[model samples]
Target: MPFTDHERAYLDAQHIGRLATTGPRGPQTRPVGFKLNTDGTVDIGGIRLSSTRKYRNIRERPDTEVSFIVDDLEPDGPGAIAPGWGRGVEIRGRAETLTDTDPPLAPGAFSREVIRIHPRRIISWNLDPAAPELRGRTA
Candidate 1:
């Protein structure tokens, strides 16, 4: 599915997103710097990426269902969860880790190793010009 302008804006505004993957021990999650590719897939990179738990989880279970989320306080205050006060996105998709180096999408992320995500189900809240509510598609 294609991402809306608001969704893309919020995603681009944030630098780090939480990645969740299930492995042998159960579900695991970690925060990592990411970049949005031109094809709509999410690219992840970090130091010692291949050795990280999130990377290992994806390698161990390529079929693992992954969920990525990026959200934050509205602004000057911490009360960013009152009613329709949240701004961010949740992406449910399949993920995999690779070692092939791709063209640089951003700085500070590992170039040799990366986690790529193909979003199937996605949702966004409180980010719209006309209607700032829930928006997205589910598979």
Candidate 2:
């Protein structure tokens, strides 16, 4: 599914997410600190000297699945029923490692290594009970 404007905006608002990759062993997932660029790409930073399974997987195959929990809705008032946590957004796309030669990393974030995700689909759902209006939507 294609990404909607709102969904894109939501993804851009987030600063961190989990990245999933397939390796020779099996599927692997890890927490990634990220930054969303205006061009609609996600940049993940980490040390380049280390050799992690995720990095290795990307080296083998660039295709990956990334997801992040953006928001969790909760009750705000007394006597008001509490709403469950809101659903998160998941993105499936091809990932590529960025080198220092690429558009240099942003300030404060270590720029030794970065992975960019080019999404092909976006999936989201609402986890709030009071908000039955929340339903899974694909884009």
Best by TM-score: 1
Give all candidate RMSDs, comma-separated.
Answer: 3.5, 4.7
Q: What C-alpha lDDT values do all the predictions have? A: 0.79, 0.59
**C-alpha positional error of residue 105 in candidate 1 after TM-score superposition, expressed in Å:** 6.6
Q: For residue 37, what is the lDDT in candidate 2?
A: 66
Model 2 error, position 95 (Å): 0.7
Give the Å shift of residue 38 in candidate 1: 1.2
Worst 10 residues of 2 by lDDT: 126-135
Candidate 1, residues 21-94, lDDT tens digits: the string is 98788988898888877788898888778888889899988987799998875654443334435678899999
Clash list (residue pairs), candidate 2: 1-139, 2-139
TM-score, per-candidate, Cα-based: 0.84, 0.67
